[model samples]
Target: MATKKRKKISQAFTKSQLVKEISERCDLNKNQVTHVLDEMKDIIASHLKKNGPEKFTLPGILKIQVRNVDAKPSREGINPFTKEPTVYPAKAASRKVRVTPLKQLKEMA
Candidate 1:
């Protein structure tokens, strides 16, 4: 039996590249594209802060939700490098954002 090798995929889009691409597609200036992106970020942040861990969806694109995580209890652990025993302190609860692609986006992929 022979195994097939999987292909490696490597590509990334930076903020500047995103602005340029959006500007070109929408026939808008780079500044305008950047402004729109900035506004979107602000709007999402404000909504999350106000609502406290709710879902926000962009139709046919993606869904984003903020989640509140509970605190972790303290525990004893060892330092890998020094091989020394240590007491790990408890961690306070934190918030995290989760993203999920919508059906349309998933189909495209």
Candidate 2:
């Protein structure tokens, strides 16, 4: 089967443009599309909560996860240019959001 080639986008679509296009394609009103998008945002946020599931998957599109990063201790190091001793500041442990594209999303690119 032949597949249609997609036009390369020079810039990202704005929220309003995205909503407009989705509404037209889905046969829904702009407000309805906006509501649906907002709900999706809320659902993803809830899923990545501290006590809730740290991972969320939109099948065939992407997976989002919250990962814990280990803290780094301060250390002494030599300055490359000056050849002098210096102390590197310690970094506090933090959580980060990681997004991985799925197979279908990768294929679309």
What C-alpha lDDT, on a 0 to 100 scale, does residue 74 get in candidate 1?
A: 99
Mark the 10 consecutive residues where model 2 has the least summed lDDT: 1-10
- Positional deviation of residue 26's Cα in model 1 after best superposition, in angstroms: 1.3
Top candidate, metric TM-score: 2
- lDDT by residue for model 1 (8-82), tens: 536666999879867776778999999999999887777678454477788899998888899999999999989
Which candidate leads the pack in lDDT? Answer: 2
Q: List TM-score per model, in order.
A: 0.67, 0.86
